[model samples]
Target: MNLQTIGNAILIVLVIGWIGYRQTTWRPVAIGRMYRLALILAIVGAGLLVQQSHGLTGLDVAVLLVEIVISLGVGAWMGAIARFRPLDPPVRVGSSDQVARFASRTGWWGLALWLVVLAVRVGIDVLATSLGAHAATSTGIILLLIAANRVARTAVFAVRLERHAAVTA
Candidate 1:
């Protein structure tokens, strides 16, 4: 593999490690932070998509769509299974002192779901490679898929947190 491939592999491992740590630990839910992360990932992924778009084929697009669906589905599933508890003294969010925060963790289930996603992603990549769809293997496309997944999870968390706040308020 070339340096770029090695770099991508390292980046994926680091991201997975970071995500795993976050999902298993009780952390304050900052909706703004989550959205910002999703946005950043999306922008970077979009840049990669543009750089690689010239070589895409119909099959690549189809495989990409499939991956996106799977990513979003798994992310939503992870979010739905996450456990949330209210913070003792509502934490301040941003510059507004009026915000209440909660702590959330997916625990072991989140890790398991992450493994499932990785397995499925690898499986799909192998299948797509056999079918000659290069996009399936592009790190940029992978990032985009991840971005989409994050957005789904963030949306679920936002909604659930809202409901939780209303009930606790």
Candidate 2:
């Protein structure tokens, strides 16, 4: 594989490892952090896309749209299935003074959903390659798909947290 492909593989592995660690633990729901990461990924992805867009075909764009939709759907499903509970005394997240009154964990179901996302992404990549949509398999597209997924999941968490706050207050 080329250097870009190898770098993409390494990045994916690291991200998957980090996500897997978070999935099994009851962690403070840091909505701000989630959004920030998503935004950063999106910005970087967009930059990469600009660098690569000249080579993209209409079919590549179509494949990307489909992958984005699937990513968002799976992310929302994972967020919906996550279990949330009140943090006993609440805890500060990151450097922000914003206290997290609730913690959430996804356990096995979230992991399974993530696996489904991975499978669907791989399947689409294969199909896209067969259809001559080379850009569909690019790192920029992969990052964008991941960003879309994270944004959807973060939105669900934010809405749920707001609802919970309303109910409690």
Candidate 3:
């Protein structure tokens, strides 16, 4: 394979490995860790995407918007289905009352949902290759989608937690 292909493969591997690590566990993620993960994604995503941005057209922009909308919906769904639990006496990472309140839920449905969404992203790569649509930039688009999904998922979870917290308090 060419060097670009190899680079894309490496990037996808990192994405998969990161997501897989998150999926394989059912523990309350530290607030610090979540922020760090988001920052990492953002940095990696932007660094890689900048090189690919030159080829994008109006049509590509529209398609990317639609994809982002769909990804946000998927993320909201994932957050909704997560099983959230409040820690008694709260495990504080700081002085704040927000003691890393996160879902530690696990099961088949989450796995299925993640896999289906992932498959759709992979499908984008396949379509881009088949149609000869800026093949070099396709991986960047896919990686950005992954980053978007992660940030969106976290936002949705936090929002839901806020609403629940408001009710409980």
Candidate 4:
């Protein structure tokens, strides 16, 4: 591989590492926090899309949407299986109620979904590149998939937590 390709490979590795680091640090999160994370991820995905060399073809967009759907489905299932606990009180003025979660290790499988998705992404990328495909073309799709997964997972956590609290109250 040339220097640029090598550099890109290194960047991808670093990004995966960063994502893994984030996953490991999960804890109780507030709604606002989760929303912000989702928003940020979405914006990043959009930015990546705009930077693409060619305008999105119908097939590209379609494939991206499909991937996003898959991401959301897996994310929701993963989120639903996670464990959550109330923060003693649902709310305290100016303090985080911790009802929403991006993702937490409190569940049975911990970061299984996150890790699995990440590994799958890397595998797909490697396979695509080996087949002489331009990987950058799919950057937007990849980012969107990541963003969608997090948002879906976060939404699931919020819904479940709210319902859980309601039932107990």
Candidate 5:
């Protein structure tokens, strides 16, 4: 199998193991694992476009490095935002006042981060294309869309999962 397949497999296992462990002995450690997986995914995703057509110039290389840093920084920020007191077996349902406040803060920050990333990408694209310097590499837009989608989905999924747990309780 290819490296991509191997990496994907490992990631899936990590996620499953984290969820299972979270239900058992060490929820905090499982949360840590989930954040680690996010970081790993961000790094892997930053390099999704590798081809002759997407060859990086010196400026493009610098931009890519910056993007990687930003991506990891965002991942760290998300992990921090997600940190909360452990839930008891009798799962709490709906939006707790505490959770609502957390969501507002977290959601605003997450939105701001994505906006900054998008702005940087657009700025770079304008600079590169305008100067006719390096127009080959073009993964930024697609990755930005994907990151936005994933972040939104994560928030929604977390809420839904909490609701389901509450119902089952």
Candidate 6:
């Protein structure tokens, strides 16, 4: 991808992430749900992965959508697991040791699983870039913009969910 597209993608992800982080508390249910939503955003990003690729035919979009659905299913399952699993020990001892420990334990697994999904998205993006003879065209730029909007909207929703949960908790 060219600098412009890359910058746009980065802006999108960061905005969404920031929104989620700002809206949510550090509670497990809220944070876990937010991460789950992040996974969905990543799947959307994956769909846009082939936007600039010449090799991506109509069949490719179908395949990408299938992949997105699969990813969402798996991500939801994993998020449920993270939410229900028993908390583990913290990596450090401190005043807020309980919270730290809980986060550390949960974060390890959550981050690991999310990283794997993210890796797939990155791989697809790279493949698309490689296949494209030119930099991101108008279609690709539009796709990226759409992905950005989706991600940002999802993040805002997640933040709202988090806030609601926090109020209840």
TM-score of every candidate: 0.90, 0.92, 0.74, 0.71, 0.43, 0.41
lDDT of 3 by residue, 1-169 (tens): 7787787768767766656566656656454555556667667766766765666655566656666676667766766677776755546655445466554553455556667767775676566556555532456666667666767767767777778879988
Ranking by TM-score: 2, 1, 3, 4, 5, 6
Task: Give lDDT per model, in order.
Answer: 0.84, 0.85, 0.63, 0.63, 0.46, 0.45
**Which ten residues in a row are the worst by lDDT in model 4?**
99-108
Model 1 agreement with the true structure over 1-169: per-residue lDDT tens digits = 7776687678778888888998899988887777787889889987887786677899998998998899899889888999998788878767645454688999989988888888888899889989998777777887887888888888999999888768878
The TM-score of candidate 3 is 0.74
In model 6, the clashing pairs are 90-101
The best candidate in terms of TM-score: 2
> What is the overall TM-score of model 4 with all chains considered together?
0.71
Worst ten-residue run, lDDT, model 5?
A: 96-105
lDDT of candidate 6 over 1-169, digit per residue (tens): 5776677567547754553443232343234343445556556554655554556565455445544554554444343433322245423323333232133122345445544545565565566557652333323433333344334434443454456558658
Show model 3 residue runs off by greater than 4 Å: 29-36, 52-54, 92-98, 135-138
1-169 in candidate 5: lDDT tens per residue?
Answer: 5564365346435643443343333232232233344445445555565532356577666655555556556544644454344444433334332222112123445555555645665566567667664532344323433354344435443664466558767
Question: Which of 1 and 3 is ahead in lDDT?
Answer: 1
Q: Which stretches of model 1 miss by more than 4 angstroms? A: 93-100
The C-alpha stretches of model 2 lying farther than 4 A from their native spots are none
| Residue 148 accuracy (lDDT) in model 2 | 94
- Please provide, for model 2 over 1-169, each residue's C-alpha lDDT reduced to its tens digit, 9 standing for 90 to 100: 7887687678777877778778889989889888999999999997888786677788988998999999899888878888899988989998887788889988888877777887888788889889898888778888898899899999999998888889889
Estimate the lDDT of model 3.
Answer: 0.63
Error of 1 at 143 (Å): 1.1
> How far in Å is the alpha carbon of 126 misplaced in model 1?
1.2
